[model samples]
Target: MTITRRDFLNGTALTIAAGLAPTSVLRAAEAQGPAYPPALTGLRGNHPGTFTLAHSLAREGAKYPGVLARESYDLVVVGGGIGGLAAAWFYQQRFGGNARILILDNHDDFGGHAKRNEFTVRGRTLVTYGGSAEMPPSANDNAAVRALLAGLDLAPRIQARPGDDYARRGLGRAVFFDAEHFGRDQWLAGDPFAALVDARNAGVRPAPEDLGAFLNAAPLPPADRQALQRLAQGETDYLSGMAGEARARYAQSTRYAVFLREKAGLGLPGLRFLRSRSQDAYALDADGITVAQAISIGLPAGAGMAAPAIDPRLGKSPASRLWFPDGNATLARALASKLVPGVAAAQGQEIVGARFDYSKLDREGNPVRIRLNSTAIAIEPDVRITRVTYGWQGNLQRVEAAHVVVAGYDMMVPFILPSLPVPAKAALRACVKAPLVYTKVALDNWRAFDALKTWRIHAPTMAYSDLWLESAPGGKDDPVVLHMLYVPTVPDSGMSARERFRAGRAFLLGTPFEVLERDIRAQLDRMLAAGGFKSARDIQGITVNRWAHGYSYMPSGLAPDDANLQVALEQAGRGVGNIRIAGADTAGSPSVTAAIEQSMRAVGSLNPKT
Candidate 1:
């Protein structure tokens, strides 16, 4: 079911010798190039060896032929993401400071989604967050998240300030409608949150008339234009039949797409336009989310309706003042320093600029060891200990731990530990994550963005949903990194949540790097042509951080309740023998805070029979 690079190369040799190879493959074979570095420019996620081990377990119910080596530890964590790292840290704090702990990850590097993508262009160092962009101040209120920040000596107030030119150079918000999706590719400049009347709102400087002009000029049918205009002007009576309270309740319980079609009387074009806005946060279309969920995330308030009021407690909470160039990778690095002393430079200083030596991660005799490029294939929990079998360095290895935490994808739990009860397996299987691709592009200079007079552009129909200049503590014309966020949702599939996630994951992994690079360049060329930007000319380097299993599935909208989902999840997470669960998936919310909270719970639930 899976073909790896090794397999492909082996087949390539036979085909070329038999004179049956394709021209492209032959040329690639004959091309004398630098040893191909898959890490440098292409194919970043569901990485070749990473998922093949999991697939062997899931698809074929495989068991390793023999264990080449065996080791024992006090605690073993099966992921190196924020959640897994924090679990080790919490275990150290709670029960044993000197416990022999080991963290294994499938990636060559740690900090799974909290990845720091680095680039050196024009002799200047630049970094961008590949995933996990920002941590809201509200999230830090959780004890676990706050404790982790405190451990890193990152006070909530010590933060990066945007350069003076940021406000001046930044494009507040703009929408681009592509010719394929709409009738034509049209770029319009406007603020998404400008129309609503609210005291808390920081209204756009553009006058109401200017905002109206942007909508009126959209290349839509007469009826669509009229409907948009009415919504924009705040003069629509779409909810005429219901009282104010009833209307509000309907909005909360019903999907926005349904509300638009049934109540707002908008056609497909209008629906598409409104739904595009949701891509900014949920990576979902209007039908995939409820109006309440949309409003909660500040997507859009319905036209002619007053914006919903924020919870007073949340409104009054402190805003996040700390932002590293690499987002929360700083937190992960700080935690790594605590777990393995010499792996990362000690924190309390400017942790963002700290140096990490990956080679020192698994030094001999260290109380806490981090083994990279190790994939957990199976986990079996016994009365006295939990045994984990993993593939490492071309061989199957085994490790026994008094307590084991499976901290990666929740759905894979059933596959990893086949003995899990039926209800527990079903509950773990129900949790599916959204697929995301975050591409960091190096540019010689940001002259194109300046020419376009916008720092960010939202494109729903393009391969990338949105493109924005990576925020740094510098000026606009400086060599900068542009971030393109792509959500490859299989739109109009009419598939269930699990099916859609599987399809999206398959598409994300199967699509090669060359295809992705071509698509990204094409999108950039199409969007920036008006500003005299050329992709090949301006673009210097590209790093695609493909995350097939990104963003945990959180229940929202008018979705029907799976009556037993929560109960089953709770039961599954209650440590089976010496094995437990950790991750954002266990928290049922996709966030760093949730990951930390779940880690704490997982560690606390560990009742080691040993």
Candidate 2:
């Protein structure tokens, strides 16, 4: 089971033509843990069930034989997130009318975490307020976003903002806390030497203060340095870096894990934090270090018979440099308005284009269809899916898709994709820092708020999450809105529907009344303050944008190595011939950029007619 890069390449070449040649090397991989690259293996699984459902639904067909008749479509999209929407958009934009795409979301609307805020103000009949916000400044560089802009003819509108390594590579949130309270900026702007002296005097040792302190403490073996460089030269040559079984693990891993197993290659002071139970969530913040120190950390550690070939940093690292526009939601609102006018229709009476049933809406007015109502039920093989099936309200509905585009952790995918046949890259399944949830608060002082407006800022909380959306053109009086995320309760894992609803309500009704509210208010208070309007009655209305669960979990050190994994993930991207996946799970880590990239990739390759 000691797989070398040579063996993988041989297997890859052989597997590529399994439809034409015998993949002996591919067989060796199959015998182990990795899910056989479908393009290489012909083993399809599923013991035919009683076929009861088919028969039962067929009974309806007998009564009305043509009732649930299957309809042929150029594409049958299984999931409807930004990725799917982008795919549909790209397909039409690239190959137009010929590809009759049918996007199916168990939910009513699209845009995964891109759900929004709805507000109402008294003495003001118009709702000139609402918008989507809180995104990585790197989105401007996102291939998918660029493709989308090109598709929509707004590429020029995307102002060219230079980005930090982290921003361009699309990793890490530009995490900012109340600098005045946390002294973050004082620490950031103050000389690194001065801050280092302060922390050192305060007895904060072993904590990374400067490049030298970090290097001095890192556990890199001098002998391994040469080999580590070799790995960085080419993933194909990286295995030579690890001593023993470590080299073998790289050959069999699901691309991401090898990074966990191989980072020992860095012969400097690089540390890994165990953020989750999975073996893969280890991270290395190698900024301010030499290029060599950064590259040394990219090799895979042996995980049984698996190893992924990865170069520590593929694009760039997250540094002090970053980028953002007037507000990050510019594209989200611009596109959401174009795609789901139903979102605008739900904005009271001002916007009048598409109409949606308000009663069928979530408390936030986001249509019911887009919400993931149930806890993850099952993930199966063949198509490797997370299946959340329901018979609630006397309706049979299911959210079935190949990959979950899990931006949180690998374990999340397993929780939903119970039957996932791929190597349970447990290391890759772990989540990073708790995702920050955002929402906006509005104060109505008996004034007519603009019902439709542009983006706004909460200035106090440094919460740029608030914005004004124009559901319908020419409507004035946008409502007062507060866009925010910074939820104190976004636990490591996901929550059930019951948990989501209660948590959401606590954020709304409990504010100024709830305990967490006091803590948050203290922070926002530092940024903004208004006391005259006291009671909730004095307040006409409020809107919140809650990503109880935010997009995929992305941290440092999550680039794939083995080419085979890329192949497995790539194959998983396609859907029912025309149907395909569009999210962070494919392409690379969880980010709007990757989501857009994968969507465009799938869109270009789609033969919806098939």
Clashes of each: 1, 58
True-vs-predicted CA distance for residue 424, candidate 1, Å: 1.2
Give one digit per residue, the lDDT tens place, for model 1 in 515-553.
889988988888888888898888888989888888776
* Candidate 1's TM-score: 0.86
Output the number of the TM-score-best candidate: 1
Compared with the true structure, all predictions reach lDDT values of 0.68, 0.33
Which stretches of model 1 miss by more than 4 angstroms? 1-41, 66-69, 157-165, 170-172, 192-208, 233-237, 243-249, 301-322, 472-476, 561-564, 608-610
Instruction: State the lDDT at 59 in candidate 1.
Output: 54
